[model samples]
Target: MEIEFFDILSKNGPVSWSPNTVKTRLCLNYLAIPHKTTYLSYPDIAKNHKSLGIPPNPKGLEFTCPAIAVKQSSKVFALQESLAIAKFLDETNSSNSDRKIFPNPGALSLALLVQRVVDRILNSPVAKIAIPKVVDILDPSGREYFIRTRTEWFGMPIDDWAGDLEIAWKNLARDVDIFSKMLVEAANGPEGGPFFMGSVPSYADFVFVGYIVWLKEANEADGESNG
Candidate 1:
């Protein structure tokens, strides 16, 4: 069955600026799943999810995007949370072993570890900078919704969050540098340049890619070179 995937819409359309949503999109792409994406704005996410019997995030927000609904013989399973959804997709579509996201038994734990560390070191700082810039590409209500909600989320206004853009980038670079050294030493790169596990792709690598995409979007929005 084709999965009904939900993604938050930007002003530009179906391409979401949210890293979590983009992460799931990449997961779906990697797995080559048959899924149709439905893009919604910020205000519409909760309504759409709730209408589909999707539960609110336990400890995070009231609702989250990047949800998927799959219909089986007798049930329609609606799942949220990118990592959980990724696990489900991998488990269900892993008949072709080589196409699996988790290459080995330890890959799951490593993915989780990378997910946590990257969220802190990379996502946190990047959000401070990239998140506000996303408003430029959102609809009017979405713009307001993002500002208000994210302000509360960050405990500061959007401008204040990235008040010193220089510091925001500096923090990202410093923490990412530290994490890079640690990650490299812990898991040495292979002959094909660099990745979390060398040449092989993993969910952990997608986590990094998601953040990179978000940063790139922000960079483009700011009319600044990534350099």
Candidate 2:
């Protein structure tokens, strides 16, 4: 049976904004897993997950995007959180041994490091640039929910949180330089390639690719060239 991939979608608009969701999607594609996406609008995310019997996030959030439900034999498994889902898929899908997501013991640690750096550091400025555009494209209800939640989370209005794009852009450039330097140092080792893990794409590559995909979506929304 095919897995059910739950993704956050904008009502009457595109559904590729969430970087976490994109990470799981990239993992699924790289593993050649046969799955189908079930898109949910922002306001409905928590309710939909509850209806499917999925557990709430341990971090106390009501729900998160990028969940997956898989039915194997007589058992059904549902999971939330992008990294957990990706790790699960990589370990469980034994058929694709050659294209393993983790690759090795050290690879998992490296991948987690990259994921953390991107999520905790690089995403701040990117969110400043993208979240406003994302909110503008959502449906009325979704927009309201997003604004309220984000305002609370950021302790300010989303619009004001990203004040001064010039500074944000400069910060983003510095973050990108740091990331590029790390990649270059990694490549300096014996193993090197266009991807994160030598010649083959790994979970690390998917983590970075997710950010790239989000940037692409944001650029398209703003009528800017991603190049």
Candidate 3:
């Protein structure tokens, strides 16, 4: 059965630019799952999810992207949240044991920690650099909604918040340096491992990979080089 992967559409249409969705996509790819994508415009998110009968998030979010609908035994099951979706895929695909996102008992805990660190420490600076660029990539309604919501959330206009690009880049560099050191310390088993858990990629790797993907796209959109 094919799974329905719901992802956000970019302003130009049919293109996706969401990090959370990318995380779930990576998990599905790793598991070799057969899936089709449904792109949702920002304005259609709440209406579409509601029409599809998806439940509200426990965090009180009315709607979110990266939802999946899977068909089994002639019944359809829908799920939300990137990490939860990844965990479900890992648990359901028992034969693909080697492709598990969480490979050990302590893996989930450590992955959650890494996710928290990225979200809490690194995301803000990155957002300061990225949001201004993101506005141009969103559709008209999406751009309006994004600007209003984000401006309200940040207690200032996105342009104003992102005004100090130099400081934001410096802060991002500093936090990235800290993360680089942590990655080095975490690497104990191999001579050339690119992931947090030595040579093997885990949920922690996916978490940061999502962020990196977002950063890369944002930089590209801004006509800036990641280097």
lDDT on C-alpha atoms for all candidate structures: 0.81, 0.81, 0.81
Number of clashes in model 3?
0
Candidate 1 whole-model C-alpha lDDT, 0 to 1: 0.81
RMSD of each: 2.3, 2.0, 2.1
Answer with 1 or 3, whichever has the higher TM-score.
3
Q: What TM-score fits each model?
A: 0.90, 0.91, 0.91
Clashing pairs in 2: none
> What is the clash count for each candidate, in the order shown?
1, 0, 0
lDDT per residue, candidate 3, 167-212, as tens digits? 9889999998877976887675554476787777788888887888
TM-score of 3: 0.91
lDDT of 1 by residue, 61-88 (tens): 8688789999887789897889989899
What lDDT does candidate 3 reach at residue 54?
Answer: 84
Model 2 clash number: 0
lDDT of 3: 0.81
